[model samples]
Target: MSDRRDVWITGIGLVSSLGEGLEAHWTALSTPAKPAVDETTYAPYVLHPLAKIDFDQQIPKRGDQRQMEPWQRIGTYAAGLALDSAGLKGNKEVLATTDMVVAAGGGERDQTVDGAILTDIEKQPNPEVFLSEQLQSNLRPTLFLAQLSNLLAGNISIVHGVTGSSRTFMGEESSGTDAVRIGWSRIAAGTSEIALVGGAYNAERRDMLLLFALKSVALHSPWAPVLADPKGVPTGSAGAFLVLESPEHAMARGAKPIAKLSGVWSERAKRGEPGAIEALVDEMIRTAKGDVSEGTAILSAACGAPEPTSAEVAAISRSGLPVRSVTDRVGHSLEAQMPVALALAALAVSKGKLFAPLEGETLEEAFEGTLTRAIVTGVGHWRGEGVALVERVD
Candidate 1:
């Protein structure tokens, strides 16, 4: 670790319920208003759907546009934004060598087929046979192929001409933590020069909603901050990506970095291990190389799920740094959570301030001065916990 080069966040591509890109999100966040959440669309379970996206802006070809599922499209679009932000878009020479690591969930479910089978279940004497028959007949091979998580990385390469070493991770929230971690590790170690990393998640599917409900974790009340939520984690749709490159690589091309990705550490502890998360947070702090200072702020990826959130709150409290949860503004996005928090932290540090609190969360404190460093935390709703440090290069 001592012989490594500095890793910088040269570009960020992020889209969530709040807005698109850094400027739009920063503006919305800084405004003194309640977090924008939809309680009626999904009823009891809240959702933060993405703002309208003009697909043509990123995915240009009509045929190419039609092939990708919603999540793939979202990731592809955000990847383009990150490439553009890093001043690498359409630069064939630079892109030819850019590495990519993506964290993504499974493809969208064929809901119509699933619903028809369910409704016809009682009509058949052998429900299991009928279910099996419908699944085989109704699901197209193309749709089946699209379900592979790596298709997102493939789609980005096909559309954006980023034909480099591409890697995709598929764990829930931890997938996000590892995606950035791996990409940053490569650049810092100088084995590779620059890399694109991040993840995307679509929570709009009935199947996904059902998945959460089966676990009894879906929020069933009005929307509020992660700290204020009386229920549990609500679902949301978001996609985030970042262009991480070695400092030397960036300076050679005159790419001004948004922030430096100083360090990233991830851990998975058993949920059954009571009080394990507090120690996980401490482990993350210890891994950060101890540059935390008065100018540092913490952007929490605290899922509104009760137990984990409570533990994260206590852990962050022990650090005594000013804090805010982007999850408070945007609902919980499983695979995209870590990168989204990192993107927000990069934007906040680049602009030198934290956003205004959405009102009602007592843990939030407005940053008093310019942000020189930030600790981005992710305490997964179910099993994993991680934290990352992004420092101002100047």
Candidate 2:
């Protein structure tokens, strides 16, 4: 009865290392290929860099573009694409009421300032005092203001005029899972007629790479698919956003659905505890709506962390469904991880066919037939696990 309201996915905006738009992804993935990676630049670490994009196409103002960080620009561009795809970009009536939910991390670091401070620290006898003084003198007044995570939502409101209520979530991968889940729940509950939900990540930062590498969570070169690696995730630069609306609203607007989102469930597992992740994933899957027996494939957001990946693989094996890790192709996008997978699911269901398997055997069963449903699973590198069941509209 709760799911009777029927939440529909009407528009999706996606940009990744593979490329942008639904067609680019589908075309590349349909072929047997490996993920695009940069082995020498990061040296010893692999990264999936974003494809070239003309920012002026989506973000017209150079001033607005200059003020925001790369991640914000990526998110703003993707948001514009989503609104355009949903036929709501310039519809002031609809834009005025369309809610926005963004999942994002803290802003990128000011590496030059950081470097200057570190360089100056060693020259002072009282390093603590020097550190404080340098931060005060060198950092720009606007630097701190620019780092707020909610700026993504604010920029979206300003750029696209999506002036409805806005919200932002901060936890890594789980943040993305909850963004979509909350959007769908609000739409289905009739509290919101329509919403834009998703996130983005900029992996081309020295600070980011170092931060992740410190945790030993960055994949080294001589790259391998997510499931194949036991070391860490190969992070990528990507932005994904989706337009979700109630079935009634979509029909009233004459906007056809790309897929139907039945339900989503999420949980955080206490790591280092055996069986914790397995049990968490199993429960999330069981709680989701739609017929599990009809699932065509599991689009896994397994972030290639040794512990979580192994446990996710085990849990999904029990579902007896073919599984393909999105990280295998695009690498992990942290907060954008789940949203990207959800977008991929919508694309797959709309086509009514599954893409060729990246890791064939476990997910190798050929379905030379129409596809109707896909189960999306997101297992965080360290903490969360989420599952969603999506069905074809036709």
What TM-score number comes out for model 1? 0.94
Candidate 1 lDDT tens digits, 1-394: 6998899999999998887899999988988687667778777788888888998999999898788888888889999999988999899999999999999887877778767776889899998898778767895534688788999999999999898899999889999999999999988888899999998888777878877777887877677677655368877788999999988889899988899998898898777878888888866865663755668888888888888888888887778788888787777888889999999999998888877865788888766787888899888888889899998878
Our model 1 lands, by Cα RMSD against the true structure, at 2.2
Compute the lDDT of residue 335 as modeled in candidate 2. Answer: 98
Q: How many backbone overlaps does candidate 1 show?
A: 0
RMSD of each: 2.2, 2.4
TM-score per prediction, in order, is: 0.94, 0.93
Predicted structure with the largest TM-score when compared to the true one? 1
Compared with the true structure, all predictions reach lDDT values of 0.85, 0.86
